[model samples]
Target chain A: MGEIVFQKPKSLCDVPLHYCPGCTHGIVHRLVAEAIDELGIEGQTIGVASVGCSVFTLLRA
Target chain B: MADKVLMKGNEAIAEAAIMAGCRFYFGYPITPQTEVAAYMAKRMPKIGGTFLQAESEIAAINMCIGVASTGKRVMTSSSSPGISLKEEGISYMAGCDLPALIVNVERGGPGLGGIQPSQSDYFQATRGGGHGDYHLFVVAPASVQEMVSLTAHAFNVAEKYRVPAMLLADGTLGQMMEPVSIEGITVEDHDKSWALTGTDCKRKHNIINSLSLLPEELEQWNLERYKRYEKIEAEEPMWEEYMMDDADVCVVAFGIASRVSRNAIKAARAQGIKVGMIRPITLWPFPKKPLLAAADKVKSFVTVELNMGQMVEDVELATRCKRPILMANRVGGCIPTPEQVLAQIVEANKLGGAQ
Candidate 1:
């Protein structure tokens, strides 16, 4: 079997992002999650979601 | 008894909180409470704890919320105006039922009032400060020893009840030095099964949030929270009564005002005026039963505060207005003198033909 190298980051929650269209929050959030996954810091990472469009970040943490 | 070491109240609270197992502290420096953050900043790094000086009180408290959501003990400290700035975050914590200790080393306020001691935040601390019908387990410490003890106690109480707790001290208690022993401070554990720990793709994910968009769901959340509050109010009211066995006038106070009231009570007793005092340790619960019971024996009540008669209203309500309630208050960062409180006690002693 082929190695599955392009799966979703384990740090990313299995939920849909609430970002509006054209918003780069999803991209940034995915990159942040990818970084956490790459760094193996998912269990210790705590995301502080502020007000505005990023408030839903905790939902996807 | 453990040996006591002299320490400032702010540093005592910080050290006691560390002893109480608070590993995460996020705060911004505000006068009268900067020592707490400074102490945490110095000690947390050495002890493998996290200490971050946030940009603002709002951000600091929100960071507390973040750590609290993960079931770790967290705290933030501020003075009056900074506490006001963090009110929104506090309300969110209340709504989310997150357990965290919020220390308010109060200064004068109505707007950046002064860096001096004041209890003007009485209503702010006791009445939930934020825009909601929620209550923070509010503990007021009058002395540096109580500052150390209550800092530990408040953290335990917050975790036990799954509610935010505030250590409501003023600039006087914050800066005052006294012999304090943190040896007996112990942290109690509670079930944090609902905390937002990562699932590791094993069990279901826990969502630590306060957003209930449906009106019915929101109402249920508030109702459930108030049910817990009702239990807290019943079981958690703490107070100290001095010379109340046979007294004509009852003085009600807390924090620095309570410390001053004690002196006045002693002087009033010396002069045969028969004055006693009820010092509320838990300000929110207000110790209504004791005040109400005292209303039957005392001729009147005198509430001394650093604010313009804030706690006097609670005294009246708690005592059911069965006796006349007088306010001996000073605003603008002024504390009431023992002589001034004694005068109010004498006046109260004369009410209802008690003199």
Candidate 2:
């Protein structure tokens, strides 16, 4: 598998994924995490999770 | 600023809200607008933000109110029916003069109209959805790009005016995909001096409430709020005027419908129809000045919408019947296409050029 490369989000900590195939959730998730990383606000963040597919993303994060 | 990437309107709004320093998101599941909630759910946690799916639309908006009271940037989103359910909470947020972002990817409705895009909520959004005399800073984004850009602007305006703001989208706008870029966003540094994050020892305790038992006191509060609105009307009104300089007919529309109207204007102009478009970027302050100016030059105004003719009334009031205003619209999930709009332009031209 050639070391199974997976990059951790710049601002977001490494976490597992629970998204369906072809879902753009991962991309959007990265963008938000990258934005926080760029702004340097990782420590003070407090996220709330809604129901549905977002629940998995929230739990993983 | 770089090459834009393809993104859905709902996704763009979520990304933009994060870039704008929004730290809290509370929303209930609803069709069309579910993508916004979905995006926020995945992203908020990684950014150390709050994302909660409230029990209902009412609870969602109230959560936003509570978060906003703490001077934290918060948002809530829903479809038309759910938005109606949040009316009371929306009014309360307004009464308290809390700054927060609310998004309604409107669907057809007097009640649970459908899970399809509709502009039937135009009056509800602009006239104040909840009971009471108040105005929300309403921004109507006609494209996915505008969704991204205006979501950021909505937060700025809300914070600036100390009032709840709205990003009014329709099902088409929420669902469609387009390229967008959010390159240079500096969210770390922002002004939050006016936020009610505990008054601290430096000032008196900050209380955010919309209640005033005394008639005279209530009157004073309302008068002050109206002044804020007047300043917003003067300063925040925004619109896109396309080929309106010498337009014989000016078509006015917003949200997803405006994009279709833009296409129609292009097609009509290609045929020497001399049609143009006035796309309102902010629906609340309603961009009346530019519309009134366009009315003076154009012979007629065509109001294109997804619903029967809700915003047409506003156009008429803005133009003050200086010109004849015609409406080309669709209902339910039905959308008025470019061909339909062009047909309307031809009819409007025959009726009379510009009034």
By lDDT, the best candidate is 1
With a 3 Å backbone cut-off (N, CA, C), the pairs that clash in candidate 1 are: none
Instruction: State the lDDT at B84 in candidate 1.
Output: 95
Q: lDDT of all predictions, in order shown?
A: 0.89, 0.84
lDDT comparing candidate 2 with the true structure = 0.84
Local error of candidate 2 at residue B59 (angstroms) = 0.8
The TM-score obtained for chain B of candidate 1 when compared with the true chain B: 0.98
Q: In candidate 2, which residue ranges exceed 4 Å CA deviation? A: A1-61, B184-194, B199-202, B353-355
* Tens digit per residue, CA lDDT, model 1, A1-61: 9988787787777787789899887888889989998888776555666667787665454
Per-prediction interface RMSD in Å:
3.0, 11.4
Best by DockQ: 1
| Candidate 1, residue B227: lDDT | 93
Task: List model 1 lDDT by residue over B307-346, tens digit each.
Answer: 9888888988898889888888888889999999899888
